[model samples]
Target: MFIRIVKMGFNPENIDAFLENFEANKAKIRNFEGCQFLELYRDKNNTNQFFTYSYWEDEEALENYRNSNLFKGLWANTKLYFNQKPEAWSVNKIAEAQNKKPAL
Candidate 1:
């Protein structure tokens, strides 16, 4: 599985507008092919700072979604509110939780 995380810092006044866009499009994003999971998070100390954490089947699936019109629209709306460039990370899960379980 591929894990994708994007952290965005927005102007405090624009936070609600950005979240509205996310709420409106989150369902459609989650329904994309090869999408495993999706969620939005906020920094506890800074409400204007938010993040999205998603899981995908692979890089190809992510690329397809990134190139879709849905992404373009959502991203365009989100970017204008940003106070700084977004930070993103793509990761691979190298270990399973079950492997750390105590032996029977």
Candidate 2:
């Protein structure tokens, strides 16, 4: 699986606008092809900073979304509210674990 994380810093005054836009598009984005999970995180110390954490089936899946019209439109509106240029990272998960009860 592939993971994509995007960090965005929005202008304090425009944070509300950003949230509104995100709210309108979150469902569509989560339902996009090859998307496994989607989450939004807010910086603990900075109310204006947020991150989007998502999981995709593969790099190709991510690229397809990036090239889609949905992304184009969402990003166009989102960039207008940015206080600083956004940063993104694409990574592969190396390990994960969950506790399980012993079989009887």
Name the candidate that leads on lDDT.
2
Q: Report, for every candidate in turn, its global Cα lDDT versus the true structure.
A: 0.93, 0.95
Residue pair clashes in candidate 2: none
What lDDT score goes with residue 75 in model 1?
90
Per-prediction count of colliding residue pairs? 0, 0
Candidate 2 lDDT over 1-104, as tens digits, reads 88999999999999989999999999999999989999999999998999999999999888899999999999999999999999999988999898999999
For model 2, the superposed segments whose C-alpha errors exceed 4 Å read 99-104
Each prediction's TM-score against the native? 0.90, 0.92
TM-score (C-alpha, index-matched) for candidate 1? 0.90
RMSD of each candidate relative to the true structure = 2.5, 1.6
